[model samples]
Target: MQGNKIFIEERLNDGPGKMRCRINFRFYMLLLSAVYFTMLYIFHGNLQSETQKPDRNKLSMGVEMQNAFLKIQPPIDIKRKVLASHQEFVEITASRLHVQQVFTTSGAKRNDIEVENSIISTKRTSQMIQKTSECFLPAVTPNRTFQTIEPTFYVYSAYLDRRYNDRFVRIMALLSLNKGNRQLKVSCSFRNSSGSIVETTANFYELCENHGRMYGGFILSCPIPNSDVCHVNVSLQIKPVHRNYVVPETVQVRLPVTQLGWQEFPDQTSGQHENHGQHATFDMPYNFSICVPPLFGDIDVMRFVEFLELNRILGFQHFIFYVSTIKNPDMYKILDHYKKMGIVTIIEWALPSNIRSGQIWYNGQLSAHNDCLYRAMSLTQYLAIIDLDEFIVPHNGEITLTNLIPKLFDDKVCGLSFNSAFYDKKFSKSTSTSRLLTARHTGRSAIFSKVRTKVLIKPSKIFEVGIHHISKPAAEDFKVDKVDTSVAYLHHYRDCVPNYGMKCKDFVEDNTLLNTTSQLEDNISSVLKLVFKERKKQE
Candidate 1:
């Protein structure tokens, strides 16, 4: 009994020690779990912090900022070198861009001179500025501070190409000056993968056609320092060099810098070398079409919109424009807006290096027109070659062009001709006029007294198209039909703005053209109102 009691005491002491050991083990495990969770939290935080670091790449400048940047210091001289005939050319991926100037007149005019030549104008003091509300004109005073109007620029089209040769770096730019002839100093830069720049600078000569309209084309055939050049930026800085009397302020026009390896192709016609192997397969061929060649001068936006809408209403499915340049930002925006809907196709119309300067018309317009014709032959059944200022309106009850085309078609007829009728701006007179949003014909009668002839042809039938007619005339191949005057006609609103001592006195008042008989008038107005309404709603 004594031995049994001693054993029980020893067992009780061992039990307390065992409980203590177990408690100590549990405390150690809990401490380890806390440390592991703390380590995990720290590691996760570090990873997140690393990911949240700001990017170190160079940022692109906004339009206004870039325009402002042009006014800085000694003009930036971007230089380039062309490849020799024998040297092996380096092929790098580059972006193609179409840069155009945005020309706008400031309300402040220089001395409010009405004459074409500023020097020849007679200065009259204390003139009463007549304000009228016929076209919502704003009230103005004869004495207002006038600042020199500087041109602004923007890139309209861009595309990526893998097979880019340094020899083919042709930069096409459209410049419109309010005053005297301006010269451009062009600078080009190529950026490699490592962010190093290789630059070249040169003076770009103004290329003009017989019509005296001028534009710029620079052939940059320079050797790029890096074989792996990924991007190219061209800056065409305008310094009114010719106008020695008036010091033109610096304005840097930024063309698009190509980003390498990014896959983006512009919506170009199939004939262009750039369109090779990347032609988008279409479900159905375009039926009726319109092709407008590259525009050089400042575009009237309101008129452009009306032109597109009226044609669309007339049932032209596809519209193509060989766009060299446009000065209006609103016009560019509207073109892009329509492009998204597949209603318009914009192609950059730069003269290829092989073509001589004389081969083009009105600053490479003829070549562009011919190219457009060739491009449309395979894609469209019929193409109406016209300008933004010209419209084909049906005189018959038939509203849509699609409806009227079949009635005029015959076994031998390859094209159709419409008598061109020109309208004077005085017929649609407006005192308070803003061309960007308001139609030129808002308050005018539908009177068009003068008439000339224009042509619309089957793309397959014609080999070449001229400014006024379709040609490459072969007795067996070419057959054109003239539409009856009572059926249809072409409406051309040519330049009617009078200069000093010149007046637009030829137009007469008539309502037969656009009032009750013409379907184009109602269709155009309704569509424009609807478009403006939708745009306002979105705004």
Candidate 2:
């Protein structure tokens, strides 16, 4: 949290100065017609083996088989060109960031800059701000801020990696100011600290392209430079942003923690249990489906509700609840919003546990399409079957979830397999008994891996599905689909939230659910709390 704070501060300082000095980008977008033509180019010789033209839903059919790792094809037209030529190399991630200045109006300008006649090259960094909304039309503005007529332009795109999203950004542009005084248009050149002439002309361009987790950036200066206002300094502190639909927990806020593991992972040795993981994602609009056993109580109900509410920002949909207890009134209210939205579905288990297990395993086999045997018996179609708290998102992508998803679907892949990113109950200012219950929300520590949530499969493909508990017998290791999940992810809030100790205390006393071990008790009492007062202030 502290590290993120510093990053935000730096971006704030420098963002404004370089705001107007960005490159006028020229993007080469491929129209559907162009894509169609390209497809024809690849499959021309094989047309004899085919019957019809390309399908309308090409994006949804089978892009995954195409192999994106292949080298890019050559441009169709030799006359076409990249608008601003990017610098080929840089010394470090830091060297690539520099500044170009454009004053609203001035006797002063940035062109008159000079370093050294010999200095010709160095590295550069840049940002591209996408103008989302316009301000001139007017709602409210400070009195001193007057409406003025200026040519209106919008930022179509911004290319920047999350790695540098909200961090301290500083730029030192060499400005060579020419002295003829009065009103004059001046041309200039820039040089490095070493005195070599780096550039000449004034058309300065800035580039910020965030292509998934891996990013690309460049600065191209063309028109001219002058030495008088030769050096322009610009910077900003960009705040870290999670582009995924699923949001992570932060220590910055209080949260209700459910204590289960007596010891946190990575801190213990002998009996250490692998953490659910801190790298999984929960992007918004991701579906969460679970088959709950009967006999769940209020604690389960409330935690799930809280988790859903917090993730509404990321967009959530499609919940399946297999009620363990038919009389769970609290559980019904837990999904009031979803129920209102007509997106929740409920199923009851009519058979005993043993029968249900058998049914589940049978369903799994049939749905996966492994044998010719189970094919006749399969019943359900599940795009994906996932734990309620496990959400999924892309590990990397340039577009937000809304756009990223289409790109994935364009790949025509089914089913995403992801591991659990865990959080545990720790002291937050929240109590279940408080008038307004609250707790510190601690989500992901960091994300170093990705997971898949949306899958293409029939429901029966997996017979019995739930969080992958390590207790089950060994099964074949199947790899999860790998997609750019920058915004598509899962977050297991229920696993971490809820003061399980108190709930367990009351629960064990009443003899419901699993037996709470002494170890569980020790961990809960010592670690969990209902710190609602602090929470109220925060939320």
Candidate 3:
């Protein structure tokens, strides 16, 4: 102890002694730290490279480029297109009500009848829905829904959605207002931003169901929009009202609708066959004379076929196909095919040679006939002048032309015209037996008038009326037999791709009516054979 004390005293007594001790202690500590750090560093480096695995979400230095080339893209809507918004209304009508004879044939009874225990009978047998019980429908003009055209309006409240996460929600108080102009009472309580009851900056708000009924307008708390309009929450309410005043369970007798959807949809189309009186032989009542009109031109042949088919389906016993301007070979091919099908009677179009010279429109047999339509009445009973592309195939096959068009004899229907369409492109999307047809929706040009054929002509009828050539479909003809899309349709040859045009020229060259408007005119000019220069390189 004495020796240690003496050594400590000596270190405190002199500067050289203390400085030497301090240096030795510092060297030893540095040496120890270097050894410990080297060992720790080696172990940590080994642990990280061996145990740490790759992560899937980690961005790597490389990515695949081939995936970008294989992605599929969306196609453009080709059938029909409209910019912005499209609104459509479909009203269920009495015609939509399909009624079958539970115990009798269709002609045996009429529409509007009550059921009897022994046998079911009908009184007024149209497709209009019969009122069974008082319905909840509001009183409006034209009680029939098919013709209901009351004015209605709706109001959309403005709101701002402030929340970033919420997209939409359902509210129990939302009222679907049907009747207009009577809303007067409502109540709700709500609070707003800035700790106030109705401040604009409030986030939590509520409607007091009573006070906010009509004009107060339900305020919605919404988030500020970073880009788009921020929609907020809203509520509505209406008092409960009793129902049961009108009829229920309206039956609809629907005819198949099968027209190819065109740019203009044909909603008011006829689908039923004619219904003539039952007081005739074979139980048939009407006679129809059908033919292709020379005015219908070469392009209207398909409409003729459809009209004739419909006439027969509606019980037209007698048919006359009046052949007028004559037809090209292609038109004849279509006619001949229908003829071989054991279809119905047909009369070819014929013109008196002298009158033919005078332009049939000016001097034909019915030129002065009944102000444009009924003049041909003397030549036939009921007439269904149709184009070739149209076919009136009935679903039930019970009604025929005579049964469907008794009014044709009435001279009321002046003229009825069906519709045809044209696709903007030069082809059809149809893959049926009519594939590769020039008359497809992607049809060819109708400019070429080869051998003009005219066969369909109706003398005049109150039901069979005027030209639908260049206008939208009319509403009056909704009762006519509606052609089905499948078994029966107007196979519009005008929509054809103009298949074999050069081939047609050869066949029609000798025929009358079309006298080569332009004969094989090639406008391409070839001077000194310079056009062939580009092809020389491949050789």
Q: Which one is best on lDDT? A: 1
- Using lDDT as the yardstick, the better of models 2 and 3 is 3
Ordered list by lDDT, greatest first:
1, 3, 2
Query: Which window of ten consecutive residues has the lowest lDDT sum in model 3?
Result: 254-263
| Candidate 2, run of 10 with poorest lDDT | 137-146
Per-residue lDDT of candidate 1, residues 1-539 (tens digit): 47645654565567558766556556666887999999999999897665444332312334444444444522222211111110111011000000010001112121122112111110100010111111111111101111112332222211122222232222333343233555545566766556677677743323322243333221232345424332345555666646454644544333322221111122222342343334222212356779887765688666786677667656676688776557765666667655543446677654444334553346555445554554554346578988887778787877668778877865456678786655656565535343321244423223332234567876544534566665542124347888875788776666554443334555544333343223334434444454466678979
Which of the predicted structures, 1 or 2, would earn the higher TM-score when compared with the native? 1
Tens digit of per-residue lDDT, candidate 2, span 1-539: 47645654555567664443222111112344577798898797576334233344343434542223122333211111221111111122113222111110011211222111001111101111111111111101101110111111011111111111121111101111211221211132334346565433323322211121111112212322221112221211122243432322211111111111111111112222244112211111122222322223344544454333322212233344444343555455444334323234343322222223332332222111211101111111223334444444334532113334434432122234444333333422223342111233333423322222223222221212223321111112222354433434444434332232212111101111012222223322221122233234657
lDDT at 31, model 3: 78
TM match of model 1 to true structure: 0.42
Across residues 330-351, which tens digit of lDDT does each residue of candidate 3 receive? 4454444333221222333233
> Model 1 shows how many backbone clashes?
14
State candidate 3's TM-score: 0.23
> Which whole-number lDDT from 0 to 100 does residue 461 have in model 2?
19
Tell me how far the alpha carbon of residue 428 in candidate 1 is from the true structure, in angstroms, after superposition. Answer: 5.1
